[model samples]
Target: MPRALLRPVWRTLPRRALVAAAAAGLLLAAVPRMQSGPPDPQLGLFALRAAALAFGLGLAFLLDDPARHLTTAVPVRRPVRIGLRVALVLPWAVLCWTTALLLVPAPARPPAGDLTLEAAATAVLALTAAALMTRRTLITEPGVMTSTWLLCTAAAAYLLLPHDRTLLVTPDDPRWQTTHTHWALLLAAATAVGLRACTDPVRARLRPRLSS
Candidate 1:
């Protein structure tokens, strides 16, 4: 990004949400080491799930800006502005995930690949919710509203499923493969929705009607 645009972009970032994201990473990274005894398998699973939820909550609010209305009116296109915001946060997200994974001892950490996929899906869904709320709902504060929805939806997906077809299956579980297929689909769909939300709304330019 150009230096001139950097200030404006940084000013528009959702600082509170970003802070929450960092805190989540810290918590995730620290939890495993805090336990005194040998690694507990159940605790490891719970930790991974907790991390995913926290990351999602943090990411869901990334688009929130109290000045969203004012920023929308700027000459810069909506996609450019939104993309800049997403780009700015991408590095932190990557770093946070990496740190969280590395902090957990190798034996205690959950299956890295599956857990990472779950985390990725959650993050994208959060972004999708934020984008939809920002552009579609036209809300002044988008994060809280969308974050609540994300949590509820995740809970529902887990509780509403049958015992044999759970969404939170462990890697060793028989349903693991199927569960991750759903996650992959979710990631793809959420990304498409976010992209659409970031795009500038098409303005219909009306032409003067001529008398026949």
Candidate 2:
């Protein structure tokens, strides 16, 4: 059943948004490499973070199905359908991030594991927000609103979050480990919430039971 849905789900994805974001992210990641002299570690970090943010912005569109209302009756469960979409896109997203990492000069690269965690957290947060919007509201296309919210929150975090407690810390900072702890926590929380939000509505689930 899932195999059959793959083609259709692939077709439904917001390809334009995804492609644009990937391109933008790759370009940003390449910025450090374009310098005339040896790359700066801090600059590499910034470029990678920007790339992650761009990818997360595109992930905000993952749940947008204009035919969402029409497909409620399909035998495939909502979570399964959502999972399929993620499965389809995961390889590409991973590939892009990998390329982004490689674009940075080895000397300038930050700890890959930690930075990868940050990217994962950002991406999951975006998806969770989109799932929440879809589950809670009548909006068929929640991507733009979710993406905008994520962008604003990122900006605010950069401008307003305190140095001691901020997630945007450098590897040399004492807070680096603590910041990634927060990232892990965020990834866990978003995963839990996103799973819940992807569930079929209670009414939808109860329809057959009530009918019987």
* Off by more than 4 A, model 2: none
**lDDT tens string, model 2, 168-207?**
9998898899889989998999999989999988988999
Q: lDDT per residue, candidate 1, 50-141, as tens digits? A: 87788889887778777877766565766777778778988988888878887787778888888889899889888888887777766867
Q: Deviation in angstroms for 57 in model 1? A: 0.8
Off by over 4 Å in 1: 1-3, 203-212
Candidate 2 backbone overlaps, count: 0
Q: Pick the candidate with the highest TM-score.
A: 2
lDDT, candidate 2, residue 155? 98
Worst 10 residues of 1 by lDDT: 203-212
Q: Which ten residues in a row have the lowest lDDT in candidate 2?
A: 158-167
